[model samples]
Target: MKLTSLGIRQKAFAYSMTTLGSSLINSLFSFYYVKLFLNRYRISEGMFHQAQIVFMLWNAFNDPLFGYLQDNAKVPCCAKRHLSILYGAPFYAIAFLLPWFPWRDYQEGDWLCGVQLVIALCAYDGMLTFVLLAQCALFAEISTKHENRLQLIKYNQVASLVGSSSVLFCGLISDNMENIFNFQVFALCVAMLAFGCMYYTGMNCVSQYEHVEKLEKDKMEDASNLSWTSVFYLTKQIVTQKNFLLFIVMNFFQVFHLAFLNNFMLIFADHLIPPYLLPAFVKSIMYGAGFICPQLLILSSQSLLRKLGYYKIILSVFYAELLSATVMLVLGPSHHYVLSMFLVANMVMVSATFSLFNLPLADIIDADLLNYKRSFPLSSMVFGTNALFTKPAQSLAPMLVVTILNQFDYEKLKDNFTHSEQSALQDLHGAMFYLVCLTPICIAVLQILAWTPYSIRDSHTDVAKYIES
Candidate 1:
């Protein structure tokens, strides 16, 4: 548990690899997938939705399966949890390009295209699930002290910021609609970068793995002995807790907010921000600023988090996000369609919320460990099991956004102009309003309601008191 400065930096950089790739892949899917595949490649809207649905189904089994595997992995080696990332990282990098490439031309409404889409989603997301589940579980397992965990999480966030900002660099490539191929090449490079970072982390970060291996050896309970049915039963037992269930609900809505912005921000910019003010590179710059500013705010507000506790701070974040979304919807169109500034504010709020949103979950896990007498595997179970709910929100958001846009004749707007674009543009405007404002406002309200009754902060305090006594 004694982490030197060098170890801390090394571990942070290692984990950053995961976030770098994760952010790149996630940004590509969230920001560019619909634009590239559906808009440029002529992939049908129906096909895009189908691929997401299929991926959701794949995640239903894949997340928990890996969660169980990591929790109960009986590897008499360095770290049972690290095994997934060690093996899965390469596939994670390679599979990301599958959906971007096809043997034949992608035709709208083509069943073959739909089938290819499903296969690609499965391949890419399956490897993603394997690596990410382990990385997430490590957040708890890597450090036991609260302050140390916070430091590590801070490092993790720095990596996340850098990874998310990678999308901005893509603007350096051709942003022209005709340069979709160039965009795909950039995506390929990002994938390789993701793999390289992960590979180094997996190879060099052996200390934590060794520590976890020792803990597993000394543990009394062995989940590996249980049947598959017990997996469901155990997951049900954990999720059925009032505090854990509420956390899951709050996290879901929070992710929905993130997914909305990530998935729709580009399209929203296209409709809301005038081309004269926020060109493609400028939009990327704004997006990067949006992500970075909140991190800086959160870092400066560490004092606020200490004094106010996570509950109040989180409530403030929700309200701040709601207000920002409302302001954007009302005044976004008024400023000559140059609303990139407001987008930065919106990003800051979202980034702040997301950056610290999971602090409670980590505390909740600590409380569970104190009460239930478990160890690192418990972290795996909590984070891994929650993905069943959280992943749905993440997957569903893009589909929902695209579906809404499609209703507004979004596909027609993407195609070569043969008729008046005025009607479609107006519909796009309406869709952007709802996505940026109404949908988030509603989600924020739900998160507030769910978060209000949460007393995990009290639970964490109670555990701290017991330790002191």
Candidate 2:
């Protein structure tokens, strides 16, 4: 299909609206949920652990289930990617609002608080997986050209710059999460705004190329005849692929690193930095920079990405992170200014690299289709299976971090910040410094090991050869 300049711009805008919506809601949840539950609500460690366990199971299960349903469904809303988003976006928005309001008046150590955490996480994740699987599937279906994908990324990142500011906006309006009423009000507004963006995208975005239509028709015919054994076999083929294994292994660590940062950056900032050294506004800017600078970096690095390719760029990012984290660890948190600068820069690089993940993922999907000689792309299935392995990290990161921090009397520190003993504060700061520095160092190392043998670089060439044949 030939797209005019106007058509391209319109497509880009429509596609970007999904990112705007997803990023806003996901950022709000990721940045604040752990803090809200553990710190604000005073959820017991045991209860918190129980919630993560339940969330992990649900998170792992939903991805492939949603993906399979979307790919195989007969309904127009499910079969057509954009329509799925249009219809599911409202439910997704409502799920986003779940955690902001307490279901009951609960005292400290209340199991009800943990129940709320579980419900909020599972509900939000289920809807998010459904909506985003469609969006991701649409991404692969919408364009096959490398340049076109980059163009989409450029536009999406621009949208993300705006969407990611939800955290900053929340920080301002909620008085950095001290004001509960204001935060709930912000959540309501965000839910409405996010719904609007997803609804617009679903209504406008198009993924109806002739080949895609043919593939869907073929897939529908195949689905009618599919059985339990064949379904299991197809899944085996997908999960056992070498590229998929490598990507998911690497991706798990990346997800963990991102979760670690998103969920705990505010906590880290508050503990590690002296109040006199960094004012609230400046810290807010730094927090906001974590979201904004990454997009700007990705935008500027489009040329570099093309030149180096995904593998090299990603490997280099890991090395940079490893080096930066190591230096920060050596310098210690006492060098407040230097530590703060490195922290923000490292967060930006991680976020920027993570943003490019979908490009390589698309390549993997293309490779899979070529390898299997399938008529239609199992784009959502591939994305979902990948998530099946990696989404657990989202739960695990917070659980493990909180577990570690608890050893340093973290709960006590939070409860009595103003009246905490100096000795206890010193120990907590030491733990925080090590946690921030060492976690990234370990993740970067593991990512490097996992990603080194990834072979999807040749997928584009394979596509060209397939086309020629």
Candidate 3:
């Protein structure tokens, strides 16, 4: 379907609502879940960790399954790819509230607490994968024209920024108030907001785009007739594609870099504005500044993106990451504003690089389609597997921080820790320096190396022209 400008804006807005909702849901859990579970409820480290492992493994296994199901699902009055979102949105929002509402009857770290955590998390992850994969698949489903996809992607990025910023409420609450009831109320409110957005997007926004062509019944029967060995063969075929493989590696590094920053941001914050001095609302400001700057930078850099193209943009942002990290390292835990700027710079570089790399992902899918000569939608499979590759990096990031801190004998700052204790504070600062600066630089460099040989330009452009024609 050829979309008018208004149609484009409406579709983009609908698609972005999904991004906004998911981002809010993710930011809330990613930043606060551990603190609430461990400190507030006093869940045992062992039990909580076990649940984390289960969540990871389950997602690793099921993400592709849901992807495949979305690719093949049949339903009346719904897009094949949108079916999951339509059916799964309500379940997803309900599952999101699971971790926050633990069984009060169970004592802290009780076997029941662990069981509840695992079950809740598993359900949450399953529904999350279902809802998100469908939303993500829309990137490929909604439009293949370069400019149209770009418009959708840009809107998605803006929504993502808004969603990430929404978590500032937690920081504000933490800094300005002290009441469990307030926190619970905030959680409930956000949960409903997330659900409403996701439901609206799935029900209404999905129809704005042309749905993928469903395989006829005879074709479905023929596909089913293929031997099960075809599955392994197809998997091998995808993993072996040089461009796709490199994209997967780049995706992993991108996620790993972000994960490292998030895992250690608390320590990084300590180096800049210790919690004793950092009010929650001020910390929220710092986070908001850091989070929003990148999107702004990205929006401004669009002209540059047009000029530099994908590879050059990757190089530019990767080097920027290295430079920002180095400057932050040199600043070495000093003035709050200066430190915040450098931290934000590092984030800008990180987010900018991530966004730049994502611009090529759709192209990579195009390349796959052209090379393989497949006609049906493969966005779900491509993105599904990409999501699979990033799982380990997400799973490993927290553990990486813990291992590094343990190795350095880093002490966690308490409310009672005095400025007079320069030794422990310095040690903590040193850890943050490596985590934010040196390690990320190394990852970025490696990603640069992986991306150097990727030559998707000609093929991607050809696909774009062909699709437009």
Candidate 4:
């Protein structure tokens, strides 16, 4: 299915909000508020970690429930794609603000910390889960073609970068508390901007009308007659194929690594250098490069992957991550933070490398259909489906970071960085270091290992034959 020039432009616009908006909102909170909960607020590290863990434990049930709801419910034309984002935008924004609202004025209480943590726990886990999962899945449900899916994700990321960059750039101008630069004002502004775009995109982006040949299927109810038979059929179908199992595992790790890295970046930036604007500047500079480079790389690589194939791209991204981690581990703190040259270079390279490889995850669904004869209505269940595993990575990385900071007592984070911040960070430095460095390397190694048997060079199209036969 070739895209018209206009079609491509519309497609890009359709997914941009999710791409841009998700990155902006997710990155800001991941770094600051999560840190605030641990550092300045003096929340118990165990309690913080426990709160996060409980958050994930709840989502274990909740993610699937949301997915089931998304899959089962019949959304009308516009509502089909946009409702979740529309409904969620305000809730997510406010959920973020809630912890701050209570924490700022009511800093002391008979159970001040306890009350704050409970509010945050509910905001992040319960309310957040619905919005995050629904919004991520919206990207997939909007399109089905492999090429279109690539464009969708590409622009989605563009929106993500714009949203994130605006935040970092604004961080440069205003104190978040005072809104000197009108930062929260702007976050709200874009919430309107992107949510409006989300709705508009869903309205005009793609042709909703398509016809299908109906195939008879049994009722989901009638457990005795239908449940066992359906279960056996799916099991036999799945067991007959070896690759599907492998695909699921690798896809799981892919989501885990992506989420893990995103969660780690904020805290890592905060400590490795100065806080707020400085780190945001360095991050923006790096991500700015990332924003441009990977898109060009992926678009151009259409020719390369045609000749060189997708496996090479996957291997390259894995190796790049491995190399970046090693550099970070070796460089430690030798470089200048003021210039942030070291950090910026590390970021540009790591981010570009991740972006370059990002396409294959989309292609994997393509690869799967080609390899194993499974055709997903939306490739999202393959892509964002890992939202289940990685959402916890969101909570899990912080839990680990806080625990280490508490354990190490922030020895490295002490006077070398700042006397005041030392206790806050020192209180939790060990946790941060392991989370920022060690966990990433471990995740990369696992990704590389997964890629080993994931070879599809020869049989990338095995599923096509099944369709033909």
Candidate whose lDDT is highest: 2
lDDT of each residue in 95-179, candidate 3, tens digit only: 8778777677555568777787778768877888888777777776566666677677688779877877765665676542246
Query: Total backbone clashes of model 4?
Result: 14
Provide the lowest-lDDT 10-residue window in model 3.
460-469
| Backbone clashes, each candidate | 0, 0, 0, 14
Global local distance difference test of model 4: 0.50
Would you list the rank order by TM-score, best first? Answer: 2, 1, 3, 4
Task: Write candidate 2's Cα lDDT for 316-405 as tens digits.
Answer: 999999999999898878899998898799889899999999988888887788898987778889999999999999989999999999
Kindly state the number of residue pairs that clash in model 2: 0
Off by over 4 Å in 1: 1-9, 75-79, 176-178, 206-209, 212-214, 218-221, 336-338, 416-421, 458-469
Between candidates 1 and 4, which one is better according to TM-score?
Answer: 1
Residue 420 lDDT in candidate 3: 38
Provide the TM-score for each candidate, comma-separated: 0.89, 0.96, 0.87, 0.73
Top of the candidates by TM-score:
2
lDDT of candidate 4 at residue 80, scale 0 to 100: 39
TM-score-wise, the better of 1 and 2 is 2
Can you write out model 1's per-residue Cα lDDT over 77-185, one digit (the tens) per residue? Answer: 2135466677788898888877776657766766777777688778887888888777776666565555555666677677777777666667556463347678778
Per-residue lDDT value at 295 in model 2: 92
Q: What is the lDDT of residue 399 in candidate 4?
A: 60
